[model samples]
Target: MLRRANAIAIFHAIRLQPGISQREIGDRTGIDKSTVSAVINQFDALGLLERVADESRKGRGRPSEGVRINGAAGLMLGIDIEPERLVVMSAGLDGVPLDVSEYPALPSESEFAGGVSAAVAAHLARGGSTLAEVRSIGVCLPGLVDRSGKLISSSNFRWGAVDVAGELRARFGQKVWVDNDARGAGLAERLFGCCLDVQDFVFIDSHSGVGGALYLEGAIYAGSLGIAGEIGHTKIVPHGRICQCGDGGCLSAYISGPALRDAFRGAGLVANSFAEMKALAEQNIPEAMGVLDEAGEILGLALSNFINLLNPPNIVIGGGLAVLAPYLMPPAERVLRRHALPEGLAHCTILISELSKEPHARGPLAVALQGLSQLNADGAFPW
Candidate 1:
């Protein structure tokens, strides 16, 4: 068991930093050199690692070899099941995406599992790969997902207690992982996106609704019930608009995509969708600008509270909200400057996520990799 843990640690060290030397892996993972060397040798024999010439080697007696995960060793699949669409991505063990596909989601919640399975099969067929080649699968959803991979609920899809990981595991016979979409996105940010070097941060995804994830000490803090970081549910207004979660005065009730669109419609605007509303806001339409300005103030107020509580160095805004950042950030920043604590506001930087386009799809790759790290040589996860 200790050997397996060391091997897994070494594997992750190599995966996170490709072309890392065995000694560097040992140092980074805090494992002894002998164990690192043995694990590297085993991985090389299994064709799971590739040796590369270390360009950083200076005047040495012998050229040091660096190791990286073998791209052809296996594949990982990431599934992002949203209310309106399903996104699937396939990547190599080295974390390079090979292919990505998007499909419309089934309207009925009961058919979601079958739909997802069919989509996976189709994706594999399109990529000329089989399920047998997949090392693991990761799934993310816009809902409250328990640590055991059970989705407690999704207001968008009206789902309840779906065993997402078990369903996928039974269908494909591969190790499966599941988590909330925002948490998945946060993991992706840490692993591959803007927050790679950041250990503590807050990630907010604003699409159909707002969602948040907290990352502290280089790991996600899922909280006691595994449903922490529900920032959208934080009350912004007393006796305000009703939210989809059957709550009143939630932050999402005022700033979510539907809410913003509804706000525009109520003001006699011609906006049909969130994108159209953004276009109107871009055109300097007074009504649209006013609506966004109000929303931004509300959002900032909520962020100020978060900053005071968590004091995160970085707060990333992603999802559809990223597209509208240019218009919203100015007012939000002003509010933060006015309301937030001087120390916390001064230290925190709000960033627009570059992974906004497909974070949900990309994020599951991180989940899959994390799950892979727990498996032993015989493919059983002891924990």
Candidate 2:
């Protein structure tokens, strides 16, 4: 058990800081140098790690070798089912994407599992890869997913009580994992984005709708029902616009992509989509600016309430929200300064996500990596 724990620690250290020296791995993971060496040798023997020339070496008598996870070791599959599209991504254990493919989303909830299976097969065939090469499969759904991998409901798709994990497992005969899309994005931040070293933070995803995920003490807090971070549904107005979730005055109703576009259209703006609205805002159109300003203020009010309750050290704005950071952040920050508790506000820093392109796809990749790690810890890992 102790040895396994040490191996996990050393592996994570190497993963977090690829090309790290054995000594540095030991320092980061708190494992003894000898143990680190042994683990590195074992990993090398298993074809899990590769040694590279330490480029940072200066005035070295003998250049020390740096170790990193091998990109060719094996592949993990990530599937993201969104409202309009299904994205399938394949990555190595090192978290580098090998291939990504997009397809039209399934017509309805009944076709979700089979549709995903067909997409995965097509993606693998297109990439000249096979299921045998995949170590695990992770799925991201835009809805309420339980700890057991059951999707309880998704207001966007009107889906309910779907056994996402089981269905996928039956199709692929591989270990499968599932979670909410927003929470999956949080995992992606932890694995590959700005929050790599942050232990506590909030991730807000504003795309088709606004969603949130909470990461506390280095783990995602899914709450008792695995739906703890539905910040979008948090009531911000008493009886404002109706949200897709059938609730009035919800935060999503005010700032979601569709809502913003509709608001712009209602105000006599010529924007057709969220991207168009962003372009209009960039052009300094008065109508677009006014709509965004109002959305930003409302978002700020909700964020202020969130800060007061959680007091997280960081809040990462992602998805479509990141695109509007220039127009939205200033007003949001102003409201936060005026309304948030001083103590909490002082400690919190709001950051725009850096994963701009194919961000949602990365979430499921993190989920796959995390599921693989847990399986390894349990000694049930197949590859």
Candidate 3:
């Protein structure tokens, strides 16, 4: 029981500060000195935690100094499959990205899942640890994931009714969770980003197609069918172009950059790629500015309704398109001024993810941390 208390206290200490000495940990957690040492040893042996030399004393340490949760000792693999690329990354208890690998676009889930499995296998073969060290695999795909972690449907992938988590369990002999990419990204944000203290908020992902995730009172609020935050398919026009999902007049008709590119091809001011458009936004091109205005307007209109219903104090936008915030954000604020309640919008802090990479980059570490949460004082979850 004391070890259990230490386990809980250790996590609390890490949550407050990612890297702290064992002595400091004992001090903060109020665990007895000898007991803390024993529990830390058990955690280390089980591959649930790692110890690292603190940055301050790079190559130097006292006899019992510089120990941290060994992030690389245990592995959490995260996968994100997009239309143009499949990204697989690993994070350890060190709480830093250990490795990332990618493959060119795949046309099917079998292809994507194969690359994912291969990546996980190769990463484990890197001498980081044996396969036994990996605790779980977390997959973030662009679709609705049922409670059982099955893919119900995806607008972009054309994947339907696949039992992803169960299949993974059968093949890998490891715990696996299938979650909507946007929502999984939001989970990372809640645990590690600016929203750590905000219990109520919305996380919006401005990707090739816009998506969102909702958090109510500090937990993921998956809707009745687990398809909440699928804001992209909502119709914003009466007879606009049809989306890949076979829906008509959806917001994808107007705001999606792909739709914009298809409409304004050969406009002579924009390039044909999202990356190039981002460069143009950086360049402050007038045409680029115009495109963001329309996109932001749609996003803001959708958000205004959400704010009225939820009244969250924060709205975090992450993903590729958010880089155009300077050009796009104003129109969103303007649209909200005319629609949302003044009280709902008052204290809202619209912030961008400050992480160097997109939210997907943080997904693996989030799962690694969740896996760590499973360990009891005995330093193992029941088989």
Candidate 4:
């Protein structure tokens, strides 16, 4: 177990800091020199890492060799299913994407699968690589996925009891893994986002509905049944509006995109989308500010409770809500100051996701890379 942990740490160190020396890896990861050297040799034997003479540092004390990830060692595939599009990304071992394909999303599962398969074929054809050369495939679903990779439910797609992993494996003829899109997004934050240096954090993703993912104890913490971090259902108001989850006064009923839109309509205003509502707020419309202020307070209260309970060092608000952090975070911070414990509130920092493009696509790509890490740890080299 210790060896596996060291291997994973050394691998991530090289991945995060390419062209670093073995000694620098030991310094960064705090692994002893001998262990770092042993693990580097093992990775070299597996063709996962490469060491070359450091020409730039020729005058260094011992002329340390530079260690870097071998991007050509293997390839991983990622499929992200969104409401409007199906995204397929082919990535090298170094987590850099080689190909990204976007297709119109379909209503039926089989149709979506067909679209993904065709896109995969086109991606492979352009790269001159076959399915046999792919390491593994990771699928990101917008719903609750059980430990067995069965998508138990998805309110967005109205999908339930779907064997997503099995179906994808059957179609692709490779090892496939499935995870909740929100959890995958949190993983992306840890591996490649602002939270790379943070260990314990909470990720709140707001879309048509609000969801969350928790990183605890240096890994993704899906509770016993893999249904933890449903922050949307944390009740903020007693006997408040009814939520689709059959709960009253839940955070989802107050701050979800649909909830915000409905709040606008309830105030005798018409806002077909959150962007429209944001524009109204910019106009200083009384009704719009009122709704937003109320929603922010409720969200803040819920976040305060989360902070009190988990005491995570950081909190990231993403998805559509991130765009409105300017309006929401202020009130939310006020609530945190008022309600959350002083120590916890003082220690935590809230930030927005800084994703460049295809955020959903990036999560599944990270998931694939994480799966590769686990595979390596288990003495199973997919390459």
Best by TM-score: 1
TM-score for each prediction? 0.90, 0.88, 0.79, 0.87
Instruction: Locate the minimum summed-lDDT window of 10 residues in model 2.
Output: 374-383
| CA RMSD of all predictions | 3.0, 3.4, 5.5, 3.4
Worst 10 contiguous positions by lDDT, candidate 3: 374-383
User: Which run of 10 residues does model 4 get worst, by summed lDDT?
Assistant: 374-383
The full ranking of all candidates by TM-score, starting with the best, is 1, 2, 4, 3
TM-score: model 2 vs. ground truth? 0.88
Arrange candidates by lDDT, highest first: which order?
2, 1, 4, 3
C-alpha lDDT (0 to 100) for residue 185 of candidate 3 = 71
On lDDT, the stronger of 1 and 2 is 2
- Candidate 4 residue spans exceeding 4 A from truth: 1-4, 32-38, 109-115, 122-129, 267-277, 356-361, 376-383
Candidate 1 error regions (>4 Å): 1-12, 28-47, 270-274, 358-360, 376-383
Error of 1 at 327 (Å): 1.1
Model 2 C-alpha RMSD vs. true structure (Å) is: 3.4
lDDT by residue for model 1 (104-161), tens: 8866667777998899999999999988899878888888887777788887677777
Q: Give the candidate number with the greatest lDDT.
A: 2
